[model samples]
Target: MPGCFINYRTGDGEHVATLIDRELKQRFGSGEVFRASRSIDAGQDYVRALDAAVRRCEVLVAIIGPAWLDSPHRSGGDGRALDDPDDWTRREIATALSLGTPVIPILFDGAARLRPADLPEDMRGLARCQNRRLHHRSAESDLADIIEAVEVAAPRLGDMGEDESSEGDSGQSSGGGVANTMRDVSGGTVAQSREFHGVNGISGRTGDMVFGNSGPVNTGTGPQYNGSTVHNGTGDQIGVQRVHGSRNGGESR
Candidate 1:
């Protein structure tokens, strides 16, 4: 039986989810966790299947991103309607809470801090239950949190073969401290647009990147970039990649 149900968005945190699944499998034997990527039956009721999996699990590990807060199940700001009646994320959270399952909220890429005021009230409650600030740190820090949360909620989860210490004893040992892993705005490396959660692109030999745009600008020679604007030697616009704003088409060498 699966001991933990890991919830996550397939778009941004897929890699993280896979990593967690791998770790869980290593820590606990195989088939201890259910991940969507491992499709069991063809044409199965995926939502129902996932819900059932959650029901059987002792822990619901919510691998959250910014998208989780704005889910359709929760009311948007000012009682705005959600787009769906049975949002998977909302149902997953509700099921976990209803079943008294420990919903350990895991922050992916510091998404908890990015929550907007427009988020729904119920979603806010979920956020309050397991704050990113309390546990939202780097992947390494989160691993420690995961170990702690599971130990607290499901003491018999992983193998205690060589390790005689009980999870309950070890879980409470780790301090409830939050670690700061945010990149330095002043000196840290800026993640390229293509490398962001929402954007995708390919890099060229000159370190320029190109993405979704099929316009002539993307076809231009010299270094091609996927940012908002490309700069030449004189700091003039050579091409524009408007992700969410105006574009200026100019040529510079």
Candidate 2:
């Protein structure tokens, strides 16, 4: 069963839905999140699939964009999609609302807060529920809040997410922990990090470096090779060199 069910209209907020799905899956692991586009298998009855997912999910995330309520119906002319009971988005949300499932409204693209007066009678409750917003400028922080909220609603997701985060935890046996492998670092100076998981080992000659323990930094005169490893994840190796009293350039030779 999916821990979270993502309900989104195809044209309105599907992109954000996909982004949320990817992030949740990355943090929680596979099969824990249900997004119709990615979770529904070919040759399966999508209606039943949707019903089952909604029923099993701990919470339903409704992605509401600006066009959500006014989007044209899929079947024919210019009728509003939300006005149609058979609409996929409408059906999914209505079912979740009727079933008393936890529904989280995530409005993006400057969407206005839902108005109960504008909603279908059965789904009017959705308007009264507190909502969250997602903006491109603050997507990262917004998603963090969203994940935290979902984790609260579904304890199973919390376990899955934490396990994934601590997969390669690094650092000393005591104190803050590190990861086994760090994500690619673009550009910056890192000195004396206490709890950073190091993976793959330093390719070149490593000076004053410890994989899991704290190490020293280069405090030499003129220019010194601090031996700070930059893992870009590409096959090619890029060296980082520190030159004192001059412009910062060139990797250590």
Candidate 3:
């Protein structure tokens, strides 16, 4: 069973959730962390799979972006998506809470601390849970801290992490499967996170392609440009000019 379950709205903190899943798996083995979209395969009963994962997990990491609670109340209801009985995000969190599973609420994308009054009756207890903040600028450190919290909540991970130090493999999983992609991406400046091993530089044209990161950038009203020019170092570079491999994780919708 996956010791950790990552929960987030598709369009909200999904990217952060993906990042968390990737990092956690690396530190604690691939089977220890589960993200529904990536963990559930085609034709599977996703409803049952989601519930099983939540119930089996020792910890649930709730990725709450700014829109998590601010979303429009469904069907003219009082609260937001939580008011909807069918909302998977709400259901997952509620199920975990109901089972008394330790939940780690991660605030990202400028999300504020969840307030008890903002939560519906079934989830008000969520507001009382101690939380952590994840920011883009402090991603590495924040993730390190979050991992520490996970280790505490899911004591099972303590033994797994001891022998799974991926210290040398982190960030090198670049340009893996489906390394580069561009689809339905219109105009504007496209930016993505990339890692080059001993490479001096890289550049691409308007119609060129590069891969990795949350998703393609959508720059409405502006032209999209993904080309880049940078100097890695002043020395004679001895680097792999090209990187190609299967992507290690799932892409955003």
Q: Rank the candidates by TM-score, best first.
A: 2, 3, 1
Task: Give the per-residue lDDT of model 1 (tens digit) for 157-225.
Answer: 744312524432433212222122222224323222112232343222221123344432322234434
Q: Per-residue alpha-carbon lDDT of model 3 for 115-157, expressed as tens digits? A: 8998877788789999998998999999999998998888889
**In model 3, how large is the Cα lDDT of residue 185?**
51
Cα error, residue 192 of model 3, in Å, equals: 36
TM-score (C-alpha) between model 3 and the true structure: 0.63
* Candidate 3 or 2, higher TM-score: 2
Q: How much is 81 displaced in model 3, in angstroms?
A: 1.1
Name the regions of candidate 2 deviating beyond 4 angstroms.
Answer: 162-253
Clashing pairs in 2: 168-180, 169-178, 170-178, 170-179, 178-197, 179-197
Instruction: Provide the clash count, candidate 2.
Output: 6
Q: What lDDT would candidate 1 get against the real structure? A: 0.54
TM-score for every candidate vs. truth?
0.51, 0.67, 0.63
Model 2 TM-score on a 0 to 1 scale: 0.67
Instruction: Report, for every candidate in turn, its global Cα lDDT versus the true structure.
Output: 0.54, 0.72, 0.72
